[model samples]
Target: MMICEINSHSLPVRPRPVQGEATIGFLMRVALANGYETPRQLWIGLRTFDAVCKALCLSAEEENTLFGPFPSYWGHNDFKYGLTAADFNHSLMRWCPLCLRESAHLRGQWMLKLCCVCSRHSIRLLDRCPICGSTQRLERANFDRCICGAWFANAQYVDTDVESVVRITQTLEASIFDKVALPSLPSLSAQEWLRLISYLGQFSETFQPAKPGKIANTHQLDTAMSLMFNIGWLLDSWPENFHVILETIQRKEAAKLSIRRTFGSMYRVLYVDLAEGCFQFLRDEFERYLHEYWRGVVSKRNKAFKPETVATHPRVTLKQAAQKTGVAPAIVSHIMQSELIPYGLVDLPSGRKVRSIHKSNLAQIKALMNGCMAIGEAATLLALPECRVRELISSGIITPLISRVHDKSAAWLIAKQQVQRLFFTSSEPRNVFSAITVRRLLKYWHLRDGEFMALVQALSESRLVPVALQSTPVSLGNVTLDEQEARKWLEEVRFQVGSSMSVDEAAKRLCLKQQVVYDLVRRGLLVTIEDKLPGRRVMRTSLEDFQATYISLAEFSRSLQRAPRWVLKKLHVPPISGPLIDGSRQYFFRRSDVCSEALRVD
Candidate 1:
């Protein structure tokens, strides 16, 4: 249509960029002065004008000031500012009636999500038209009137104490736009304040009442501003004030969940460098609560909040170190106990002691472990009995490079090179075989599986191999075996099957389920002796005594003519005074007690 001269002084309004005016707001003023109907039309016209000019005359800084304000000022690449017409309501634009009446223009500050109340007038910003009860769209034909033909200048206002919010907004703006230091909030720099408010705004949006669209309500805006203000106040006093806030919110479950979720979000956002001054109060509280709640929830999944002891030599706790090394906490503890990786004990202010390792040592630990394998892993790789592997270690044929933790059953780390050397150069011609292979060999030799296993147990108990090199006392279902050695032993020795057997074998002999036998042993009705090779051993006499002296709950119920479930319910309430049977799952009663209780119930 018609072209207007393109200079700041030549424009009709010559409106200077106000302190809080967003670039889009300034563009809106330009469209109005140029007699355009809407901001959308203005955008189209500008694109067409740029085409005619052959090159976009707007400098990079100028274009950024207009459309890039939100993302650029917030310092986040992924955050969408929603400056276009489709996202107009997402920003929750608002205005003060008094300010509009005085200046006859919208300020950029009013477009911010955190700008809820007018600092100058001490009143809440009105986003919806009071007369028609519709959200003011601001794209209307005129500046001071709504789409429904209501004048915003005439809307009612309510008094509010938004001084703190106003101060925070002003401080953030000065710090971000002007690069000025905020002397009042000395603990946080300008960038930190921006990040803090950004987080607060995102959190506040979650509290908004359910609505039809993505736009937030005015009340939601007020709540967000209040939250940000209170957070700013808390920062003045730091961790002490933070604890007070936590105590106050503990009674409110929704608030507590929200705060906990927010802490997790902060951890993700802040990443691994959580220092003393970075959101001092929030960071401290985050770490404290994280330590308390970490076991089942965040400990395994999150690694962002690991505290750094020093800048040059950063240290991580045992749990964190384990996570970095991709191993278990017990393994890390064992490594520290053996002095393989140097570590120190830190006494916390809460009177708790924690073992911490330097981050630089993580690579060293990984390298050391890489060259070695645990005893079980080595056994699997070499296809040898775990017991035979231990024998080699004891005989000094394969010396373990790392020792086990004292009083703990954690496996020792042995150099893989030594094991390989022993396997290749040994005169015995060792043949690594799995349990399946051992079973085949037993079949080939015409020996029964039970009798051969019993002989192996006797050999294990004869103190021929040190306890450290013994096959683990647990089941040998997954154990690797030395086939040549096992074949030689079977050919050389003749052994007798014992009168007693393992719990599983006992269950089969007594014509009862395995769990039933375990229940009897748990309740002290049947006694067991601990054996090094095959774990718990049960005597035939003990099983016979249990069969004679104790009765099942079902039998007891039938004897008393009562329902089994009813009897079980009564027994569970005030539980019997003895060790729990089946870890509190099944309860056993002596036949005499069962008879007396049955009679009493009858």
Candidate 2:
């Protein structure tokens, strides 16, 4: 009844399409029937690929008898996947040699691109010629001879370990007709799997930056087809096999096992080869595998993914870890540098290794810190002055979470919990423990840095009692010490220096020249007590009284960074006592007057 109306340049002879034959398969068979070199030449002779496609879909009733009514878009799905209709059959000419001899037509099963071995024959399909090492074409009116004049079907299919590959091919082909995704594998649609097979196959080995390889012979094409086939087997089992493949690859490279080296070309293929929407499932599953099994460092520098949807990633960035645990990044780094917390280094373009603690150790970083505080807070918590706390830390009596000497953060982090457990002195206050804290002794006695360290060490060793605790601290101004005990310690320290002052001794104490001290003593502005030694001796109280109210012109000039004459003339601030008033060679200004006028302090 109906006929496929033809153009002037139409195919000469047409055979009935075989039942379930791919439309492209029908074209190749027609090309052979018409004695064309290939299906492409046949389509060219018939004007266009679309023109040939239309005639086949609407052929005469006698030619269409092998199949019933046909839809206009029957084979469009297979034709549109990265190949033009003219190039489709030639580019992917996979076929079973024995099956080709049995029936000289491409089977519907071979149209499943993933089908490596023939379903009926159970032999790997050959795409390239076995004898002349040339890709086999749909020859003119002949199925036996290749373009190189060799018998194509006589080539025996080599048997190898293709069981998994064959099985995977069956699985992927099943997904197409059944319209169901395999439950064990990632749930990708049929079209997605069809397009993704060859794209994913190249990632099976370490990626060389060369061009796409040519399949020169049957063995080479089989090897190439096996790559696409192996992908399904690798994915069918899920992560157990996935991890095995990665480890195997690492073993082969013999280099360090970083994810970047492990999944060499996979990342490039995912991020750059395919669109994100097409292979999103594969990308996500691979990323999950990396996060779960790959115990390597990950960052922006390497191609490993940095996708963290939830705040609770096992391996988080340094800043994220700090924000989650309420710890400073510097403290976390210090913990890692001291090897208190274990960490690994991620790759960076700058070659700076980031400290990456495992989730287990990351949690411990927060636990080990009962909480961090400034040194001042630590001193207050321990009921000791900041200076005393610093001394204790210096002498290794207390261990801080962050070492003040080692870090440049300028904030010493001491564990408040560690400080609370310290024992500054006996709990009960006796008469020996005075109400006055060591803070007062520091100001009153002018303790040297070494003497202060010794005093704190004595307190740490239980040699003294702290009678009072600071409910609140004015920068650690209070931590009680016995007044009598403190006085006795200072007296012993003073007596060790002897009861006297040579002119040099007096000048050093007063921060003046020897000549100035001599003139001041001669003027009776400084008093000297008797000493058994030959040197002139100034009493301890004398230096204190002299320095308390009056600042000499020499000290004033040094403080202002000017000469004495410049201070007297340009400053217009007269001294309270001088040669005219005190009969002294040295001019002395009151401390308040010098501070207010020379330094512009209120």
Candidate 3:
């Protein structure tokens, strides 16, 4: 009989490790071949497993095959694409049913969360069993049979019709498994391609808010999969459509003067990070586009605009021109009205009308407001406390070009973005990190050995998008920004999801050794949940795949290369279950003595 007997009976079937088989997969096969329910039941310790391998006289290649290219880090799969523990699909079994029916060996690449499609069969991988309506457990006795007595090979799956998903998966597979460059993706290393895709995904899809700090789960993995949506389309076109991405980022930046301060983390990733030389074309194009077309307002009074920017975008408001030259605002307005100076009256977004001054006429408005301003006026200008301004002077941060600090009433000043530049949160989804306000970012958050400008760029780029919107104009003290960068995505999202259970309790439920359970939980090989309560909880489903008592017609059709219904009709045998009788799509045939009385085929 094909019925799996999971008792004390020990019929050892220690097989040679296949070249591309995963370690956990080898253990699963070894246990099942010997009629054991789980691999841990067949061994006392990892030492015993090693001893069995020693007895087998396995070669070094075999060892590497079974344990992965790196045995030490094999438990966590850090070897694959520089992803963290939460980014992989190690928590649950993701299977290509047809592949299991054909080879009955697990492929290591399936562990990647990006490996959603099975190219060989052109079908989406099945996570939940069709019959049981539950996610599969790795502890089953049979690969083909689900614990619910349904055949995996017969389970109908959704086809991967999306060309981008298929192409991207294939590209990733080739890079990871074969250790080659992406077939046609813009000249980037395998790891860099992954990074580029991830950053772009984070930038583009800010509308779908993720539960930040609570990283990956089954649902979250699905969300992560969605992140790969337009990556293929973007890469297929290369730098040609790259401007579309830049435009998207620019729309989010509240700061318009400096690209570094405005584009934020996005800027650092492209230009500051030297290793990303493959993105040089993008950086060059970005600079070119800004120099020729950008019209950011400039003024000697604002100081935010660089000397280079004045030559590039020299337009300044009448009030700013007056502030620069110490001339009255009315005189600057009157000069523009009389057409004595080359200028235009521009309507601001806030509905205020202001005359703009030309670059040639800017010398007429040259003056300094810094030294003469009172401490209160300087405090208001810099959006800081008088004490903080004094401290800044003491710290040598406040440069006195015109102010004499010995005069107690005199104060130094710099223009601030002020209340008009106040930040507001959008329903548009940003990133998977907890949002920190610009106010918080500029004032409260501390980064020891971290770049402060990078955080500012993240806020400006909306990577660490606004969470709180101010209804009334608030001071710079209230606009918040917490740390956000490419690296921060992996570091910060650590909130506990679900509840907890003891290790001993988890080990027994999952049919694993206590030590094995410990390793799995630590490495995130299994789905580990943390609550504020106690230890992490392990949600191990039951392992009851006894045997293949019945066969589905789909399985028969696969072998016979005929239609399922034709194969079923030609068999001339009554089925145990069918679409007509039990509403099950599959037609199951009893295998003689084990399930029913024997029947002979014509």
Candidate 4:
């Protein structure tokens, strides 16, 4: 008989790290340096600052000094002291096109304004020249400085001066203004529009027109961009479409320019910050639902085998296939887009066919699907869960499959498709889990098993279930014990899946002077969750795996057909562990030590 036990255990939930006061200060410095100048960004900074202060249990006055409106450092002129050039450098390293080498200008000469050959007049045309700057004679010199003329004379041809930096910033700003318009058009989706809005705001902060008596700081480009968005003049219109939004914003900007020109970018940022609450509201208001309504189709499984032979093969539905595979129906639809399978085969209702590659070919398929070679085997071969493989499937973009597989006790299997899908490297499915799907599932539906069969059921059907080979903690019989002995025995067993021998018996068997058995439990070699004789919570210890510790490098070298030096290099082991012979012509190494090092590397 088998049992599915729920411990009724509500595991302690660790809270997400809330930003503290110091972190808020750090963030403010970062934002100031990174071009987070818009009113929106300031609001976000203030909220973050306030929350952090509250988390740190700061006094009301201290909180006010840090994040309060008007007189606070955040709103005062002195806030710039908290930020530095290094912060600017770090920000540029992450998001700036020029600093990160993501700009198209790196590849070739970028035409700024067309200059005439006489150096007197300039035009916006690409082919024609501005003043003395004829398109033909135009030597593509790196902009060494801003219009102020500072130059970087390094052999690497990299410019570090603020003047040239400002020119590039202006160029990007112009690109955004010319190519992209505010509130965009209805032709673009809401998500695309939102993304563009944020991108524009970011670009504006990075590039602002230099003011009189103010030196341009490449480090402060991030701040400038933020300020531009806050001023609202950067946006000409918020039209519902291409023609309307652009015209409106342009008209409004022209009107504003004609009026008092006192609207400095910094003042504009201050205005916006006062209006918008900060980052959270922006995120919530602008979040786009990137998922589309996918129509599920009924299709036959690609089981090429004879129907009678594989009949009771337990068909997994289309929804189930999506769940198990960690793939979207749309993506599966893309795979089988137009590829037809044999008729009369089992398939899902949404035109999705049940496909099966030969177990031998599974490895090849997995390689094409995911990068890892043996991961699919860990789930399919080892009978682990689908959730275990999802992270590996998603890679670093989301939770790693390793996180799911690790249950703080033992690894278990979830879904075979998750295993196969994650391990197959050639192709990958994107946007498999949509926010809406997750939200709906979590909000209303109960979580169901995504796998085709349970572990025991699958093993039972195949008759491949492992039999007891050696004495493990699970296999041990409990003996009579006093309370102290029982406590000692319990201390010797920790929960380790696939471990054998009862906790008490294993403790009894290992009669050591010190707490060696207890050490194993602490190190996660034993599992003490199972019910023992007389109803005590006792578990078992898994057999010690030598692969975890030993690998013979010398033997490995001998097995390789390649040159010994090549094998040694591949093994990444030191060639010698003993004193060198005369003139370093030869050296000696301990075979045992080499093997030991190889084991550690593995």
Candidate 5:
């Protein structure tokens, strides 16, 4: 193993010896592909993580904080992030080489691990317990020791801490390849040469080219790479037939590159050429983050905030309420019928079937199940439909599938498939008859026998009693306003008089004002005058007539080059003024009198 000094720390790195004829022959025999070789530098970090925190050095604290303390990596597929020794042999063993080495080291440190049954462990991402559902704890065997008190065979254990193991693997490989250059091996004996040839054959058959290639085949490629590296490690020098192998791999890689380029170009043309698509992409990502952050903040706020009075809000349906309480739909349904909690549910209309039940009901189910349950029975007990129950099978949408049920009404089962379909298919549209269209037709006929007959005749001519779906009037979800609502809506007009405007607040409520509003009141426009506010009166003056005839006193005098008749009369007839009695000018004339007495015409 080669070591590199990083930050004053000696770290094991990858090994790459100088090239030679025998090694080149081996690589040629294996048909080593070029694209398959992702540069070691690309994976330095992942390899380092594994090297620094190998199984031998890993403590419970380190396992939990750094590498996965458990037997599996948390977020990726079994083999992703890193590899291990076992990963090379079994598809199920997901470890990468670097990860495998580190994991081995980690197990050596732990020495002994609790068994699956005794430790009460399950797969890291699994919701359903693998063994003894009642006991949710199951642990893995340590590198050197098993839960059965037996020493580990060859001290070999697969470490699920992917990232750390990957780092270590890369670090080791880098140091070995770049810093430590071992000399080429001498010709091997016939038996040894045959074995090496056989291994090379296997490696070539399994070789996978990565990048710009099919992503689905990544696992296969990863496996081949692991095997190749192992063989390379046994050989002292670099492979010589690299040129031919690299060329073959390059052809495949080129195909992938072309495909990637074509699709990328198409996407750019569709989204970026004509608009600000790059900005939109950034905006969308930002908005998504903002929404996530806000949602967390809201949840925290809701938990922290308290109110003096708790509203007795109606319960929403199980389908709608599942997201809020973090409870499965089956559990929610089971609680709905749960009499043990002495709780009742109320259904509230939110344009959907929503019902809410007390949280205590759920506690009862958990107690009965003893913490966990099998997949099938949990759904049965929850009284959920079979389809709905199956949908949650992955994350255990429902915690404890009820195995036994004494009461038919109390227990429900929702199929796991059904819930998946419901959630995934929410965007689909549903078919429904439009009642508004029928109502409009009824009004058009007005219950008149002749009109109804005419309509029937039209339908009959179209070869139907009821209109054909394609021919049916589309529903608008609305109707023309009726007289009462129309009148009420029209009552908010304001009338300008001098510097101020006049409006009837009551008339405003009626949606009318000024002369039209006043006229309506005078002609009993409203249902009743007693309904009007006190001191308010209606008058009769069409707005058109009023605007044409009326002018301010000052404007009228200016137009005539003399005071208006009413103003002159008002000056001649003085009014009294006092604290008790307000002072005012009084003048009046009929339209006929003004027409006859006015000497000038404008």
Candidate 6:
């Protein structure tokens, strides 16, 4: 028939193309209008539907709009738009009975993987014939009739809560057509949204419960949609809520194993363009779970550092050696400075000379340097003044393996075990006190100056033996104690008092200022007992409590034997209730916190 004659003979009941209708669906409608038995019959040849459109008096733009694939129809180049012929299944066409009854045609949106529900009727689309349970075919002349001779228009329709489905549809439509600006998710672009949808589909297929074989129908689409909805919520809040989901997933052992088996790693599941924000979130989540959940699965083998054998003298640069040995570059430099490792400047092809160490000597140097400390480091480790350490060295009490620098100074590398041995050997007597205690005892005894001087002179010559002090800095001087014989004489001379004492007595016992004791009481840090005569007296038990619970930050750093900045950086301070002490921002850490931190540092 002539094109003009065919146009005149076109069916009077030609329906307008529905929004987001598939090319196949539109072709089917045109076929029905032109008295064709089926859409396939209207095709002149493979992929040639121009003849049918020309005969029907359809314009080029209208024909292209109705039948063109993605980029032309959806205004995007990506096949993820779900417009290709392969995207639809001729043997398994899904349809909403209510939608078909109202529009008398199928929509292109229904053919997409994302299209799980009918937005108009708020009902799930069915793929199988309701009565016979046979999958519906799309080749039928009429869009509403099933292969089983069932008219789906008369089939019972079930209502559904299509809120998620509606949202998914709107988001997909907005992304595809650039319809509306989604301010909530400003980081997402149209392409990224499309990729996210594609990823959801792939992820659902990978992790979904295994059946006998692959089935592409409403069930698969529903699972993908459900996953997309949940993932959408996760992406909305990102890492915080995402971390919660990961924790939950990790708790279910079976699910965790399934996920690992299916995806292998989180990175595999989230592979996408690095520029995408979703990619970063997924990567961070993956890394977090990698450490927390998949640590056991990861290989822990150390990579050996091997220098190139091409050179006559095989050597590695300081930075390269550091990386290979898993040691910091600064530490490696210190080792070189100490002359523990033989190093020299090597000429590079770039005409620059760089310091390098021979590979053969690295092992011996690393072993010698391991758990060893320098003179200053040893003093800090031993909690003694550097001068005291020097005196001990001079007296041959603490011997060190000294490495001589380039005719400048020697780097004393003391073995940590030796330092520990010497530190623990000289134990301080808990009852022993400094010279201040002798004066207090003399005053308590009501001794006269001449008697005290004669007693002090005698005690200084005989009973006053030097002892290694605890807590106090060496600059303050070593602690001196009365000999065992002198202790018996002192007991007979001075009266023993109860544990609870006055603030002045507490200050002498604690080696702190009386004003400091009063300040502690004022700050509610030190418990005190009320006394009408002495004003307020701090109990000895309260002093002991203060000693046990709190220590000045400086003392804390000394105990740790690390720099003040290092201590502050490592300490994770717990929330405290009250305001800090006035004047200086002097921190007083809980003794328990210090002990725990010490253990961690060690």
TM per candidate: 0.37, 0.47, 0.44, 0.17, 0.16, 0.40
lDDT: worst 10-residue window of model 1: 205-214
User: Global lDDT of each model?
Assistant: 0.54, 0.60, 0.53, 0.30, 0.30, 0.54
lDDT of 6 by residue, 497-519 (tens): 33345677666666666776666
Can you write out model 4's per-residue Cα lDDT over 1-602, one digit (the tens) per residue?
22222122211221122221222333333333334533235344344444433434556654333310221333332222222222222111111123213221211112111100111111111222222322221112222222234222211222332332333233333332233322332233222222333333432323434232222442233444343332233333321122232233333332221111222432333233322332222222111110011012112341322243233333333444455566545433333322321111224446645443222322332332353234445544433344433433444212222233333313332233333322211112223222221113222433224311222222224322222222321100111112342233223322233324554556554432124434444444333454433432333323233223322234355555445455555554454321232222222234555655555444
Q: Candidate 1 — which residues are off by over 4 angstroms?
A: 1-20, 48-92, 179-192, 200-223, 229-233, 247-281, 284-602
- Candidates 1 and 4, the one with greater lDDT: 1
Model 1, position 510: C-alpha lDDT score? 58
On TM-score, who's better, 3 or 6?
3
| Model 4: ten consecutive residues of lowest lDDT | 114-123
Best by lDDT: 2
Model 2: lDDT of residue 471: 35
**On residues 1-602, what C-alpha lDDT tens digit does candidate 2 reach at each position?**
22343464465675766655655566667667766655555544455545665555545543332211112232233333233222123334567788778876766556444556765666777777788867654434354577677776788786645566666566555554454455555555455665566566544434433332222331345554766555655665765666665565555543332565555655556666665575676667766765664444455555335446222346765676788889888777777665666666555556666556667776788777866788888777655667778877877656677874888656787765556545443345455534566667776766754777666556666665566433322222455767877665655455454445556676876767788788877767778876775667787678777888788787778887788777777655677668877666778878877777865521
Ranking under TM-score, best-scoring first? Answer: 2, 3, 6, 1, 4, 5
Error of 2 at 50 (Å): 9.2
Best by TM-score: 2
Superposed by TM-score, candidate 3 places the C-alpha of residue 4 at a distance from the truth, in angstroms, of 19
Model 2 lDDT, residue 525, Cα: 71
| Candidate 1 displacement at residue 502 in angstroms | 69
Candidate 4's TM-score: 0.17
